[model samples]
Target chain A: MAEREINIEDITKIEGHANLLIKIENDELKEVRLGVHEGKRFFEKFMVGRSYKKIPEMAGRICGICTVAHEIAAARAVENALSVKVPECVEMARNMMLISSHIQSHLLHLCFLALPDYVGKDNSLEMDVETLKKIYKVKEAANRMTEIIGGRAVHPCDVVVGGFSREIGREDAERYGKLIKEAMPILEEIASVFLTLDYPDIRRQNNFASLYGDEFSLYRGMIKTSKYVFEEGEYEKYIEERSIDYSNANRVFVRGEDFMVGALARLNFNEIDGRAKEMMNEHGIKFPSNNSCHMNIAQALEMVYFAEKAMEIADEFNGCSERGEVKNENGEGVAIIEAPRGLLLHHYVIEKGKVRYANIITPTAMNLESMERDLRWHVEKILNRDDEEIKKEAEKLIRAYDPCISCSVHVARVV
Target chain B: MKIGVFSLTCCEGCSVQFLNIESDILKLVEKFDIKNFRLIKERNEMPVDIAFVEGFPSNDEEVEKLSYIRENSKILVSMGACASNAGIPGMVNYAGKKAKGIKEYVDVDYFLYGCPFSIDELMELISCIFHGKEFRNKNQNVCSECYLRGVDCLLDKHILCMGGVARAGCNAVCPYNGHECSACRGGYEGIDIKSHARLLLSKGFSEEEIIDAYEMYMHEYVEELKKWLKER
Candidate 1:
């Protein structure tokens, strides 16, 4: 019998600040805590009394990595409150911005952040020069797409409540279309490198939650969980959340159970492009995956699907379309979009012309419970290993979720 | 010289935006020994030559970390709006928990300002420090840069833009795209905010809207706006 105590004071190479603590007694895992110590930005409470037209701008500060996701979700939530229906072209424009976001986020995570671990390196900077260039080229192109469509890579100004303030001109559309086409092969090659990596073979069945739909869409969808499926309007009724004393982020549960969301969840529920199915086969992988490590592969495959979607939107581009006008009505709205990581929810209550209340639940916050559970399960198999090895494996499991700590701590349901 | 890039509690947009420098980032890696950037590297050595810190000290842990950065580094450059004037994270400042800037806690030598800050300025500052030259923070407002770029004045359209007072460095990207400047950067070297408010009020924009255009952020300009109203 042996006792072990492991504490990763700060996990490195991820988005924001986080730590892990574990206590083992008699060779059995007793206590494990995945602590999200990032300070609360209080976006939900600060947004109170702010004009509805500017929530997306404020919301964009939630997470720099997933800025577009917050902006789109906030805009959709604002639109829902006012009962404003945007045009098909406006939706198309938003969809393109989201797809571009997926490309850059996935590229950044897999290459700059997560790739080094899989490739037997400390970080991507330590990798060979040629590999870094290839990743840089692909990442740069993806970032350019996000910049072109969303106005800036980190916080977008073009994405507004009703629709984009600046119209997508024909020249911009053509340039965007060309960028997607040129970057396709390199992006696929980069995805192949990740998809074909040697990942830990740990598989377990758990509940999956994501935006429910058949089409390759991120802007609109229903809430789909393994046990139950519900519309975005019924989210709070189905998804139960309460804050714990230790972490600033609330623990989210579906039907009173910790569930997994993000890229893997969406792949299980949605219908991807036809070529993507072949891709999983090509890489000797399958959908509805149970392993957490497979989340990386899911993200890689998603990059390909999103690029094609971006191309389709680009080809369909004709001219500047009309944006929806805000009515300044009083109501409540909830928007659920499949962010690059997984399900992103932005809910708002509008009274007069200002935001009366806001409740935002990010992908990382939803994945926290599952992460702690998986850390326990992961540590159990490697209990005999030393402290450093156990720490690395646990971090890999958490990193596989691509958890954005800032997003999780960015908002809370405060009255 | 060793380089360290640290983040406290922010969107980490400034750090993320650093990588968005695209190809120049690769060249940067070859030029500088960036040993302590947690966003890209895992192995980090301390007591560096230049330390660029984003986000403000919102809690005790962050405040402790800031002091450590100041103590360990030779040149401490407070990067972005959060570290400079408590950017979006400053929203908590209004709730009575003031998120103070880095300069409030530590003796900062150079300051790089922007919402996500300016990567161009960051790169320029690094070379200046590396080459033993002085780095001067941009003092012009976004309106000046907007005029230079020929971006249409949103004020002419009755849009309550903060470009007239917001610091320049982001090249007026938001205004050029037809969006108003939300003042992610702190105010430029200022003389008169009262007259600007007067102009905005004359343009039929409500005083409240103009104030919120700056997002009521914790900055000197918003206070000036409030005090001007009080004097009136």
Candidate 2:
């Protein structure tokens, strides 16, 4: 056997940092190693000695891509710590903010991150000028929605512990409603395009986890996996974190086995409603696919579902009798929201009206092991392929997860 | 050719920024062997030629990890604000007497400054290493590289900026963008807190408003600023 070594340092175009190492024998891949060199922020430690009221604001800094998830989870946690029951108006408003985030996040991921891989471009910037214009249109819609709700794309400061710092007036919601209504057709088109894209043929059967609801609904549900419905405080009972030597973030296993979250997981669970099911059926997507690569289609499908849900929620809030307000006190609480990626959990302990401790479990952390599993499967299956081909194939598998470690680490980047 | 990258206690944005570099990063991967990285896979244990360490030493485990990296690797680069002057995480030093035992925190060698170190800086640092160049500390403040084109200070307009007292390298992004500086880069060694506060007051800002702005934006140093105000 003849062995040759070629080093691949920083693999880009995906979220966070990663490196690829391919070892070949006779021009066939024998072993592949992915080295992700991203740093970890010990947010749990940072939460200590900080005022509980500020946890949501601080945690909101986690990731620009999924700031709403962080803010919502932190707010829920802090509210729980103080044992304060937030008003229904606040809940509805919070849900609206989350829905807005979902819309923008899914749009950004689908158009900017995941689509470029299928479109054979390095980044959205590399897309054909005409196609790039279309992508920008989608981005503009997402940006418009984000501004209407959270204030900006990166670190939105409007969300507070019990409620939002600023209320979206009837006029604001109406403006958002118009943008969301316009975005629906574009989302439908994107979903259709995703359905037509050429996806990898690799199939790996993995259990899925997500907040439960019908396809068209974004609010209200416990985390639903195939075998269990774990309520908010019961999250730890279902999902356990194991220490790993490679990454600072722990490898999460559901019920003593590896599971996936995000697009593939959401689709596999199939807890969505009739309308979403009809849409998926129309697109020829059969649920519980062993071929996780089809998760991108699921993501696109969810965007449509989420957009419709956002419109519904916005409409409902517009009809509500009361405005939103923040309730204060100290206690412990937990919240899990479905971010664009998957289930995002924020747990907090509050003392004297400040956050005592905070723990965040992002979808990417949950899918880390699953990502490695898919990578190994792809590498082994393509062991006979050329080194360059193997590298490209492996990268596609990683991107399929759309991992958001910045959310897991609870930080933001300008870019 | 093996590389090990680890983060202590700080925002992970610098690493994410590296990922944002895209194609240049892919080219770097085509050159070097990566033995261990936490953000990529679950496998661990490999010999490394270069160790990129981010974050500050917070506790015993972090200290142990930093020491391990220093002992094992031929080159150790402290790559972000946390690694340099403890960055934002080091702000725990201002949490009153309760945080006075910070020296008991962690041990480290080498320091890189920046709230989250810039990707361009990381690339340059790597280039300097490959070319056998010595590492040099950047002593400038964020205002030095700020893209503001030398507009009059916002502080001159009664807005508080840690830019004068904070270390540089963020290119003054916050202030240049019309937002007040948060001093996320950490404090400068020779900053005179008394005079800085007095300058803001002289600019027609109230003492309470100045303190509020500082505490709101740069919460980490609130205790020290309060102590300085008491003396004045």
Candidate 3:
């Protein structure tokens, strides 16, 4: 009998550092740990004692790729805490920001990070010059959409607790509408490229959880699983996060079950745009795909959905003043928004206009457990294979989730 | 020439910005052999002619990573505010451990200064290196850019703008719009932190608010600024 340890010290092409540790004894898998070694910045802990107004800016620093999502989620939480009702226009602008983020992040992931793996390339740098330019153009369009609504692509500065810091005009919306409309073909082209990729056929029918609504909503919605539906604020009652010693990230469970979130989950529960739906149907991928590899296809479909959604939102927005009065008192806020990777939760307890406590559970944190499960299942399937082959298959499965390890790991409250 | 782009503990925004260069990035890549870039290319541990390192070394492991990178490369360029002056990563000063810039542990030949590092500034440095041309680095305050753009003074609205002292070349992007400069680019040398504090204080901002403004990006100098405010 022989024992072996397969340790991948640093996983590349992802946002942050994570090491996959697998221990096998005589062909039996014993221990599996995905250790997220990103040094804890203690964002939730440090956010305490800061004014409510500054929390969005501080929270935006969590991840560069999804800064707009963090800022929006933080703003929503603060608004929830303060009981502030922003105008419809502000909500529209925020939606535009979220949509823009999905486009940018999904493009970056599918094209730069995940695409290479399927295309038999080591990295996106190996992408042909023409394909690279086309992808970059689409990304720039998404960034432009974000810039029009949120002010800038990276860490939007306009979103405030009550509303927005600056008003968005109808002309700007129209301008963005044109840009988004123009990006439709490019997005389809990108989706076609993703469709060509061969995903390893591995299916695990785990519980899928995402925001359930009449429409595909990244903002206000209730958590919908296969069995139960929980209100947005009631997430704590349903899901519990346990702090693990080996990793900086926390493992979350819903009713003692590990579930997945992100494009696959969102698609499983909600109705996406018609164009995206058509594209998905063309490939015989109906909603609620159990195959994790389908997550990449869902992401590509989402890019198409976001482009159309952005244009529609742009048309409806008539412009409004950004000022909303805040009557701040002691209050608690919790916000759950769909980040590019998956569902992101931002919770804050404000006391006398200052943040007394903060907790952020990123998408990658929720996916970490499910990622390990998928890895174990895949490893067992390829147990007879060589070590390098196992490692490659495992890495591919992990990348399929588009895990932002840095965004996932943060300070967890010890009981 | 072989070039490498490495990141440590901060948001990899600066490295992303390099990709944000769009089609221009393809042209740039043609000039230099990118021996190592974790975000785009496969990770390579080989030595390079120039290495652009982003983020601060917050832990011992990162310190080792930075040391190894510095030792391998001929010219080490601190790519963002974090690698140069401890940007947002240093916001946790009370966490007991100091988040240090790369230069704190190893020699750095250049500092591509900004919160996320300006794309233009990065290209300027790269152009100088590739073309063997002399490029003078500018350290003007953000207010200078505001002046050039003819943007109205934010101070007129009794707003606390860090542009008066914070490093320029961001085109005063924040102030040009409605928002005040939060000083994501950090401060220039010879600026009086005390005077800026006094200005904010005189404008009815409390000492705490002024400190918070400075602490957002200027983690390196906030302690001295706080001490100066306390004495005043």
Candidate 4:
């Protein structure tokens, strides 16, 4: 009978700081606002006087969990702006980095962060020792793959704009290939463990977006939406970011509507095959599943997909090739890659080899609208339930996106 | 011991690194009570024996929370470069007010300095604390590690590497792996920044390039380097 406002501060297990405010009155949802309060680092503005070559390194610091994703996106953007044709080896190296990145991030989300929720535990620390050890093995394998290719598990050093700074020898490739080969069954065991967990059943109709390619991709791909298609550089023309008073992150809209991006979105649009597809079918996960909680399952399945993909890439590896020199020019480029969370975009405008303007749109910002929609649906469904129950379910839905508020907030443009 | 892990403004990379040492952490947790860790725990309130605070306090809210943490803990350790030296998040401070580290607002018992803190050092620190042993600092520069590992000196190749000046203890992972040192760790104490700048300039690197390289990670100390250069 009275107005009820619920405010959640610093949601746990996600990458950054964000809060949710929901108001309801007389069984009708009044307003839902997702707020990001991470401190403002003016990354876009700081790169104004910097050379295009430094963009990826600077941008890579934007997120630690998705450093490889940001680095690749920034490098691709610079390469696109300069119209530089990267060597074939560079593309292969980048794909390796992406697959490795996805593996680590997905394992982090699925086993460490999201597992506690479905299994009735506080955190992975509370899980059984054997289960934790298996998860650790997956994380280790993922990190080893990154270290083999990118040179560091975190912010990789060898991956530059034109090509890599070092070489991945046959020994390095074979070592990680062995790790991936050993990781496949471990991943299947992890997937089987996740399949037993409880996933909340809630579906909402929303447009799904992902990079359309020949196969499930984290590297170069065409932009595909549910209905229309666009080029990577043409994102600004269709996707718009609007500032809100409640949060520093700008809520993004695709063609004036809230669309979804991330693992679930990828699953909805992309045709997945092999071990991952078989696992999904075994678990009865069909396409266009709007359940946000299924994102955890999607992440677990992605681990299988990326492990197989990484092994295939590693098996064909000969050695690193000569990197060509990059010729800078005055041009604009937009590069989009699928981060561990979802679609990540980095746009750069270069002038005389210097970055005149730069903008980055992280997946979390794009997911905020849909996350809020999910919260509203779930909260309203359980309005008559206990308040504690509603809050628990709401937080669970929000964490499913693996939102990175630190990546979402940039105050340089605002200032 | 009851431990708390807190974060503020920077990317939570250091926390991820802390968790990345998965099996070791599981063993460590058995020895100590993890009272509060927001990344892993839901309840963040407890009487903490030691608190490992990550990220820099870039706003008033962060400052208030950090102060509360300092008040509630017996010993507070600034973990990672952001907390101790305001790493990448503090780069914006170059154009504005200097970003304050944890020590700026509250007393810090120890400082574990690195862009993303080193896992080995973290393990050592934890072991020392649990055993009540004084943790000896590694005072050598990264170049020493590079020399020990037989990693080629980038200076000979005319590639600008920060190993000669940046602090050691990262085991020269970057250089040994074929990438020049980017100085994820802060500089060795009292290293000559002016000489390093001149060396880079003689190598045909532009002044901007030298300054940019030196100030990328630990920009908090760049002001001191500039002052020392001016005096010379």
Candidate 5:
């Protein structure tokens, strides 16, 4: 086992199918190919000839975990192409949906995907039932908040170009408001328990980027980092997306450099929400972190932060009114938003009310290259460790980044 | 009964919906051994009493995996529009190439339909499997459930709704939520596709609108959809 040519097929605790092939020849790391083991849905290819009205629904199908991410991003993109701007209230609700959906997504990552690793278990089910129940209860409240406003958790019906397809009533907003209030403390309790785990740490110079806002926000932002900033419309000037031969998904580079996106990236540049920041300070967690495992901590903090935000939006929502008027026209628009995972970009050109061109760069594809780079560094650093320890450490590292294989595989395979 | 939840090449929305079962999801782990649900946990290569697989076999690796899972389980429930009919991703076949589902590669005991089905319906199907009860799929149209729920028909408002011929088991949720029923569920038994299109056309909708609605789940049957739209 010492002279190992390890092929870790089907890396667990992530979405879609991804594997790693590591060739350690004479105990020297010779090759590390992070393979995307998925069937390319080629969403970009299929989006051609689709009506702008249909683009959000179809694009939203690209990933279930971040359906709202795709729906809102696509809707905003189409709305931009049509030069349509909904009333302030409609924008508020859209932002509310975007913000609340993160609560569901972050909890899903923390409770189901990453928690088991901290406990040295294969699955969360192996944990005691009471702990699972408490977490699910909190997660259920988050789901209710998303569904009450966004139509449903998986694929929101109200989210469409030109504003909400249906107005979420005042009663529905208040209902979710109460639901989230009751669950917030329980969420904090779970976060306290999770923070006690022995998190692995490594400081690296990985480039971190996210959507920018005055305070922590997911919608209506430009891409910002320590080195540079770019407007949503000027996304192309700063970023380049190209196919990599080893995977089904395309990788994004910020001027030929692999960077990170999602919560860790968002926190690196944006002003933290006051309540969320207070919670972080209480727990002794600070931002601009270089540790990859801190990504999970970032998600945990974001879960509570967004949960508080969801409560405020749900309480204040009067109802959706004065939605944007959609007209059939030809134009192009680009939208950059922070998904639960990281920065998600949706760009579209609509011709005569149909989507003529679409390019979606997901957080997973954006993080994949950076993740592999980190993987290589960790594997080389631990080459002297036993095979069992090596595999366990490898999985924990990959899971920390929370790569969504289906989201990444949505890109057309490059030949 | 031991259960396994497997997702292939779709959005994994059905899996998210399963998690949307919420706190009952904890009860689910207590009641049944979910040997391999990738979303909640890893270690997905084990045998089970009931296998719930979502999405289509979109590649050689998936086709091979589907065959292996079929061999490992006694009952395999194809768990969404993608598993049953390739869902929206079936649009990749608009070029006349075929989009393949789990059924194409192996035997499927039952289906829970939708772009993604509701949690109640999924639990009901799974409970039936656990109790050894005879299983049945809802055979009514979406309009039936909408009517039963006293929902306003979008058609009356000239909204070009597709509920008249869409499958009903989702309890007409899209319509209840003030949507026009884009027909995520495939058409129900004896669905009157021609008349539904004609009626929408009479209400000021275009032929293209009707075609686009069906494309959500029936994109693989694009030829038949256009044929049905044009007839009479």
Candidate 6:
């Protein structure tokens, strides 16, 4: 029997660096190791001794992709610590900002990032000229929405500690509403395009986790699993994170087993409520999808759901006269917002009107275990393939999660 | 040529910027042999010709990785603000009341200056390496470029700008775009801290506000500014 050692020292096109090591014996994979070579940022250490007021600003620097989520989560946590109540209008605006992020980020991931994989393109640029144009249309719509609400697509600077530093006026709000309304048809079209792609036929029967509530929401939700739904505070009990020997990002398990979140999880949960069911059915995505590989389809479906949800949220604020405000001297706070990736939870301990301690749980961290599980499954199936084929499949498997490793402030794309 | 790219402690935007280059990236993929790139797919170990490293060395593990890359690669290029002046993560050094900084806290090598590393600049560096041209280490402040381009000084307008103290090569992006300098770019070499602070103070800004603004993002510089002020 012949033996070969296959190693990918760096994987590119994804965020952060990960090493893939596979030992092939007689063209069969014997052992596989997915090593995240980067070190973790000691954000927990950095948070100590800083005034609570600066938590949002400081934490916002964590990940450029999801800065708004961090900002809102940190600010909400601080407000809770100080026992302050934000105004209703302020809450609505905050919700609008967060929802806009979900719309922008999810669209980018579905069309620009993940779609290229299923379409057999290296990147969005490599897609067919016509398909590339459609992708750009979606990109433009996302960018327009992000600018109108978050102030920029990458790291939005509009969100401040107590609330938004600036408010979107009626005219701007109306313009934003118009943009979402105009983009809705395009978004649906993009979803339809995703429905046409040939997705990898892989499914997992693992548990699903996401923050679920009324009407396409990213903010204010309880942890909803296939088995149960619990309030935001109960996440600590349901989702467990353990430090792994190899990765800085902790492995997450729900009820003592690896679970999945983000697009697939959200879609699965939404299907139970008849949300986007027709679209799912139209796209041939069935609920209780056992294959994690189908996450790409879920991502596309969620894009349509998020766009419509954004339009509905914008319509509600269009005619509202008053915003929300919260005032409190000192108290603890916790905020959970579903980022484009998955559930993001921010907890703050405040004292003397300052943040004492902060705990931030990002979506990628929550999905790490699911990634490992999928990798194991993939490796098991493709162990007999050539090295190049094995490496290609491995990357596709990981990209399915759309892992945003930079959310923790310490990593970058894998190359 | 085999090239290795790594990140230490950063927002990872610099790497994202490289990915954002779109078509250019595919060309790069065809040109260079990637030996140890973690942002993409995993690969086997091979000899490296050039190493592009982003972010700051925040801990012992990072220290080891940096040393390994430096030892293995023929040329090492520090790729972003974090790798340069410790970036925002360096701000953590200002936590204590007494004077201790990130440099005193973490070990790093060489420097590339940008809040997020510029793809155009990186491409230039890579091209220079391909032609066997030595990459020049930037020793100038970001203000030089801002002044050379006749860009308006934010300090003159009572708006906060760190260009006076920040390292250069970004071409003053934030200031040129009508935004205040957030100092995502790291600090400069031979910065005249006293003069910069005094200039802001003379412009009707309060001392507390100046200190607050400076300390807000790059706290490591605050103690140095305080020491310089004390000497004055």
Winning model by lDDT: 1
What's the lDDT for candidate 2? Answer: 0.63
Candidate 5 matches the true fold with a TM-score of 0.96
Tens-digit per-residue lDDT, A1-415, candidate 5: 3457778888877877898987787889988888997888878887888878878888889998899889988988888888996787877777777767787788778888888888878887788978878878887877777787777878988676777767767888788888878988888887776566777765664688987767667887767865888899998888888887788888789888888887888777766675667878878877788888788888877777777787777778887746788765899999888888898889999888877888888999999888888888888988888777878888888888888889988756324
| Candidate 4 docking class | medium
lDDT of 1: 0.84
**Superposed model 5: Cα runs more than 4 Å off:** A1-3, A413-415, B94-96, B228-231
Q: Which candidate should be chosen as best, given TM-score against the real structure?
A: 1
lDDT of 2 by residue, B1-232 (tens): 6777765555454543444444454457656655555543334455588877765554455567677777788777666555555543343332232221112343333455554455566777777777878756556665665535564576766555667666665566556544456565566667666777877778787666566555533555667878877777
Total clashes, candidate 1?
2
Native-referenced DockQ of model 6: 0.24
User: If ranked by TM-score, best first, what sequence of candidates would result?
Assistant: 1, 3, 5, 4, 6, 2
Candidate 1 stretches with Cα past 4 Å from truth are: A413-415, B94-96
The collision pairs in model 3 are none
| Residue B229 displacement in candidate 6 (angstroms) | 6.2
Each candidate's chain B TM-score? 0.93, 0.76, 0.93, 0.92, 0.92, 0.81
Look at candidate 4 and tell me the lDDT of residue A326. Answer: 76
Per-candidate local distance difference test: 0.84, 0.63, 0.82, 0.81, 0.81, 0.65
Share of real contacts kept by model 2? 0.07
In model 5, pairs of residues that clash are A262-A341, A262-A342
Model 5 gets an lDDT of 0.81
- Evaluate residue A146 in candidate 4 and report its C-alpha lDDT on the 0 to 100 scale: 89
lDDT of 6 by residue, B1-232 (tens): 8877666656666654554454455567678866665554233364577777777665566667677777787777776666666655665542232222224443433345565666567777778777877766566777787888787777777766667776677776556544456666556657776887888778887666667557644666788777766676
Q: By TM-score, is 3 or 4 better?
A: 3
- Highest DockQ against the true fold, candidate: 1
Residue range A1-415, candidate 2, lDDT tens digits = 5786646564554555555666777756565655544555455666666766557656765665676777778777666666665778777666667777776666656666677667665555445666555555655666566656665444554566556554556666777778878867766776778877888887775578777664423444778886788787888788887766555457778888887887667667655654556677787778778676777788877777767777776777653334333455566778787777888888876666556666778888788788777777777777666667777777677777777755543331111
Runs of candidate 4 exceeding 4 Å displacement: A410-412, B94-96, B221-232
Q: For model 3, how does the per-residue alpha-carbon lDDT over A234-307 read when each residue is reduced to its tens digit?
A: 88888888888898779988888888999999988988757887887787767777988888988988889878
The reply for model 2, stretches above 4 Å from the true place, is A4-7, A22-33, A213-220, A270-279, A319-328, A409-415, B1-226, B229-232
